[model samples]
Target chain A: MAEAFLRRHTPELFGLATLLVCVLGFEALIRGGVVNRYIIPPPSDILLAFERVIVEENILARCRDTAFEMLVAGGASVLVGVPIGVLLYRSALWRRAMEDWIGALAAAPIVLAFPLFLVLFGRSPKTIIVMGFVHGLAPIILKTVEGLASTRPVLINVGRSLKMTQSQMFWKILLPSAMPIIFTGIRLSWTFVLITIVGIEYLINLGGVGQLINELAERYDLPGTYAGICFVILVSVLFFLALERVESWLQPGR
Target chain B: MSISEKTSLAQEPALVVDDVVKRFGRGTEIVTAVDHVSFTVRQGEFVSVIGPSGCGKSTLFNIIGGLLSDYEGAVKIGEERISAPHPAVGMVFQEESTFPWRTVIDNVAFPLELQGVAKSERMDRAHHFIDMVGLASFEKAFPSQLSGGMKQRVSIARILVSQPKILLMDEPFAALDEQTRLLLGDKITQIQQELNQTTLLITHNLTEAVQLSDRIVVMTYRPGQVKRIVDINLPRPRTSDVVGSDAFGHYVAEIWNDLREEASRGMADSESAASRRATHG
Candidate 1:
C-alpha cells in the first residue's frame, strides 16, 4: 500500500519526507545537545512559540505595519518610475545619460543608505517606506524603458500610417504592447520594496514585523525570534499571493 | 468623408511621387536608395511596384507613405504635399503588424478609435469589414490566435476603417505561402473594386503583380529607378483563374524579362560584397 501511494504521489510524498527529516533531525540535534538550543531552538519550542505569537501576542498588528509600508512603497515606485521610464524612452540624450546609472542603481545596495533616509524622513514608518520606494524605483524605471523601447516598430508604423496623434499612439499602441514587460518590472519593484521595508525595519529598529524579530533576537528569546521570522515568511507568502491575484485580474490573457 | 468627398478630391491623382531621392550615410560612404523615382496613381487605379532584390522599392514606398521625410522632391496625396503621415494615406506593412494584445474586432476598430469614432458605430463597421475579409467567425480572436493571412486581414480592415483614399502596401503578402498570397491578392482585388480604393503594392512576386495590378511599374537594381510601366489591360473582376489565361502569362513573361537583367546584377553585387567581407574579416 505504501509503495502504491509513493508511486502515485511521489512529488508530494518526497516534499513531505524532506520536511519531516529536517524537523526530526533538528529535534534530535537539540535532544542530543549537538546544537545549542539558545541559538537554534528545538522544532517543538518554535512550534509552541508560533501558537503563542498568533493566540497570545498581537503579531497581526506588526504584519499590518509591514503590509502598509509595502503598499506605499510599491505604489510610489510605479507612479514615479513608469513616467521616468517613458521620459527616458522619449529623449535620446536622457536615455544615454541615465541608462547606465539606472542599471548600476538597481544592482547597488541602496537599502544600506537607510541612515540618510532616516535623517531626511525621520525615524518613523515614513523613512522605511521612502527607503523601500527608493530601492524599488530603479527596476521599475529600467523595465518601463525596456518595455516601451522594445515595442515592435511595425506597430508604430501602423499607428503613424493611421495618422494617430502622439498621445493616442502612446496609449493605444505603445502602452498595451509594453504592458507585459512593464508588469514584470512592477513585480520586480514590488519584491524590492518588500525586501527594503523589512530590512529597514530590522536595521534601524523601526516598526513592522522586522522590528519585532529584531527585538525578540536581542532579548535572546530564541523560539520567539523563530516565530517572528515565520511571521515574516507568512507576510511574504500572503503578499505574493495578493500580487499574483492583482496581476491576473488586470491582465486576463497570457 | 463619404464617396462624394472622395469624388470631389478625385480631380487630382490619388497619390504622386515626383523626383523623390533618398540616400543614407555620409560623404563617400553614402548609398542612394531611391534615385529620382517618380510615379503617380490615378483616383481608383491599382499600381504595383516590382523590382529585383536590393532594389529601393521599399524606400520609395516609405517616401510615398510619408514615413521617411528626409528625401528630395515631393509626394502628394490629392492636392496636398505629404511631409508627414496624413489621413488620406494608409500603409500595410510586409511584417506581422497586427496588435497581438487586441482581438480581431478590436484591431479592426483601432483606427476608428484613434479618430474618436463612437464605439458602437466603429464596432458595426469593423464587423462589416471583418466579414468581408471572411474572418467574422474569429472576430473575438487575438492576433496570436489567427494565421498570418487572417492577421493581415485584420490589418487591412483597420486601415479601411480610417477611410484612407490611397492604400500603400509594402509587399504585404511577401511572408505568406504562395497559395495564401494568391488568395489574399484575390481578396484585395475584390475589396479594391468594392471600395474603389487606389492602391500601390510593392512586391517581388511576378504572379502577384500581374494578378492584382492594373499597371506594373518595373524597377531597376539598387538605387531603384522606374525602368518601364506596363499597363495590365486585363479584364475586371479578376480571380485566381485569371492567372491561367494567356494575357496573364504574357504580362508575367514581360515583367520577368524586364527584371531578369537587374536580378542578375543584384545577385552579382551581393556575391561580390560577401567575398569582400570574407577577405576583410
Candidate 2:
C-alpha cells in the first residue's frame, strides 16, 4: 500500500523534496559566507524580490507581451510550414532537391539573421515575431513532410480503393495518419519559438521578462535578476502545461 | 426456394478478370508477375486463389480490386469495365488495415460516412454488421485494444458494412496462429454463407481454401497463370470441424498436388538468391 502510494505521487513528492533541498542549501551557503551574496541571492531573498516584481514591477503585462509574440510565431509556423511540407510530400522532385537543404536550415544560425529582420520590420514587435517564426519553421516543415511521406501504403490503398476523392483522402486518411508526428513537430516548433522570442527580447532590449532581467542585472539588483529568471521558468512551465493539456485533448487514450 | 436455388436465379458473372497481365521493370529485365490470367466469379460464389509465394496472386487480386490500374487487359464487374474503384467492391487486406484511432463501429461506418450518410443512420447500419461479425460487444473498442483475429473481424465488418457485391480478401488470416486461423476461417465461412457474399480469397493455406471455397484456382510459379481449377463440392454449412472429414482432406490433398511443384520451384529460386547474396556479401 505504501509503495503504491509512493509510485502514484512520486513526481510531486520528489520534485518538492528536491526543491526544498536546493532552497535551504542556497540559504545556508549565503548565511555561511561560502558564496558571494551579491552575485547569487538566497532563495528567500529571491522570493521577496519575486513579490516586488509581481506587485510593483507589474510583470503580468510583460508576460502578455511575450505570450502574444509566441502565439503569433507559433501560429505562423504551422500555417506556412504545413503547406510547404505538403508540397514537398506531393512533389518528389522538389523533395529530392530540397530535403537536405531543409535539414541544413533547421540547424542554421537563423537568429543571427535578426538584424535583417529588424531592418525588414523596422525594429518593432514584428522583428521578434518574424525571427521566432522563421527559426521555428524548419522543424515543422521537415517533420510534416516526413510524417505524410511515411504514412502506411496500406492506408493509402484503403482510401483509394474506397473511391475517396483526393481531398477526402487527405482529410480522412493522410492528415489523421500523420497527426502524431505532426504534433511532435508542433511541439518542437513551440520550443524553438519560445527560445527565439526570449533571446530576441534580451538582445534588442524588447519589453519582456528577458529585457527585465537585463535591466535588473545592469542595475546590480541580483535578487531582482533572480526573480526575473524565475519568471522565465514560470513562462516555460506554463507553455509545457498548456501543451500537455492540448495534447491530451487532441489524442485521448494515447 | 432454397438459398442455393435463389442464388442461381441471378446467374450473372459478378467479377471478370480478362487476360490480365501484370509486369514490373523496364527494358530487357522486365519480369511478369501475372501473365494472361482469366477467370470469372459468378454472383454469390466463393472462389479461392492459392499459389506459391511471389506467384502474383496478390497482384491479380489488386487488379480485380482496382488498386493496380496499369496492368494489361481489363477487370469488369457486371458489364462495366473497372478502371477505378467502385462502391460495389470491398477489400480486406492481409495487413491490419483498421484505423487505430477509431472505435470498432466508427471504422466499420467509415465507408458510409464517406458517402455522406447521416451519423445516426450509419451507426445503425454499422452495428448490424458488427453483430454479424460477433463484434457487437466491442463496438466502442479501439483497433489497438483487440486481438489479431478480432482486428481482422473489424476489418471484415468495415468492408461488409459497405454492402459490396464483391469481397476481395488477400490472405486475411495468414498472420494468425493455427487455432485462431481455423476459428476465424469458420466464422468467415458462416458469414459468407449467411450473406451469400461473392468473395475471392487469396491464400497459401490449402486447407483454408478447401474449407471456405466452392472452387479453388491454383496458380503456377512466377508469371502466374491458372495451373488448375479444383472444384471442392463439400457439404453445405461447413464449419471448423469440416477439416476433420475425409472429403475436406481429399480436396486439401488435390490442391496440394497441383501446388507442390510450384512451391518447390519458388523455394529453389529463393535458395539460389540466398547463396548468391552469401557469396557476394
Highest lDDT against the true fold, candidate = 2
- Model 1, CA-based lDDT: 0.88
In candidate 1, what are the lDDT values of residues A32-60, reduced to their tens digit?
99998887999999998987776666789
What is model 2's C-alpha RMSD? 2.6
Worst 10 residues of 1 chain B by lDDT: B6-15
* Chain A TM-score compared with the true chain A, each model in order: 0.85, 0.89
Candidate 1, superposed: residue stretches over 4 Å from native: A1-49, A219-227, A245-252, B1-12
List DockQ for all candidates: 0.51, 0.60
TM-score of every model? 0.88, 0.93
Whose TM-score is greatest here?
Answer: 2
